[model samples]
Target: MSTFRSHVWSSVGKKMITGLTGLLLVGFVAVHLLGNLTLFIPDRGHAFNAYAYFLEHAVHGWLILAFEAGLLAVFGFHIVAAVTVAWTDKRRARPVGYALVRNAGGKSRKGLPSTSMIVTGLTLAVFVVLHVKMFKFADHPSVVYDGKEMKDLYAVVVAAFKQPLIAGAYVAVMGMLGFHLRHGFWSAFQSLGWNNDRAMGPLQNLARVVSVLFAAGFLALPLYILFFVDPSVSGGHR
Candidate 1:
């Protein structure tokens, strides 16, 4: 047990955990963003709810519970792995404290993203809880579409975003999410030793693109709804 625990606490183990969990989260956010884009269909979330239903009832059906459970586990693991790795890194770097450091090939050390991961990640974690409570756990009014009556999730979102404060918070949080992801996206690959000379540059570039796309894609939704969508149409959240 001691050996196992020691190994798990090793740098290599922590990095592996971080990389794997980060990959899962990356995939999850991508799918989640695609689903969120459906809100723009102008049907008042009809399609969005249908898609949600399909996942919860028709498509994966019972499997959705398992999937969600797995997602929760992954999210939890990522948080732990990230915090542990960040703490470990800090401890190890202390002896070299205040000394200007350089990475391989003489790149600068500890830019904004690397230094801010734990802070940004914790902020994002709080945002996720609030977001889920506002949308998922909160009661959604009944809505009927295509001869099926379902919860009016669209209305809930419309109501929430209608408040300028809420919308503003979302936008800010999204920015933080992007900032955190910027380093995480590429670092995950590097942690896994995928940093070959030929591919590293392109890979890092791709990661940047992915991070920006996610940030912008998520940011666009709230901004569009706040500036363009008429919240009165969806009625009250409850």
Candidate 2:
């Protein structure tokens, strides 16, 4: 038991935890993006509202609460494990900075995405808190569709995106999310001992493709709301 506990706290073990949790979070993000895509449906938010209603009412909402609790725990664990690994790496580095800086080519996978992980991760952390507060906890006005009334979450989303400053910041943060995921997607594999010379290239390319799709997917929503979506639609006026 002691041996297991020690290994779990060790640098390698922490890194493994980070990798696993990161992949799990990535899965959640992808599903969430898919759900949010309903915002683009032309039915004046009916489709999006129905989606939101289903999630909330599924299994009488107990299942949703349990899943949220589990997700929160995973997020907490991922943050702690990642921060600990990064701190360990920093502490083990040479005290004095290197005199010369040179690119080590393919042998070194370091790049903007790799170096900026900490910054982007922390920034996204803040964004997540604000995002939840804005959309999840905020009071959403009710709307009726097909004789059923549900929270007009789609309206809240539209109203928020129509603001230039909010939309700009949202788009910028999504760009950072792309940079983070570009490295994180592949880095998770490397940390889990799944990467080798034969697989690294394809994994890296796949990571880049997924990152762009996610970032662009999210960025498109705010832009579409700002430019294409009329203010009178989706309760944006109220």
TM-score for all predictions? 0.89, 0.92
**Model 1 clashing residue pairs (backbone):** none
Clashing residue pairs, candidate 2? none
Give the residue spans of candidate 1 off by over 4 A: 1-5, 59-61, 94-106, 235-238
Q: How many clashes show up per model? A: 0, 0
lDDT of 2 at 138: 81
lDDT of each residue in 1-238, candidate 2, tens digit only = 9999998887767878888899999999999999999998888888888888998999999988998999999889989998888887788853211112221133566799988988899899999999889867888799887678788888888888989999999999999999999999987876676766677789999999999999999999999999999868664222
List lDDT for all candidates, in order: 0.78, 0.84
Tens-digit lDDT string for candidate 1 (1-238)? 9998886667667776787889889999999999989988887677888777677785547678788889999989889977887777678844222111123444544689778889999999998888778766877688677667777777777777778898898988888888888888877776666655576678778878988999999999888887888876763222
**Top TM-score hit:** 2
Poorest 10 consecutive residues by lDDT, candidate 2: 95-104
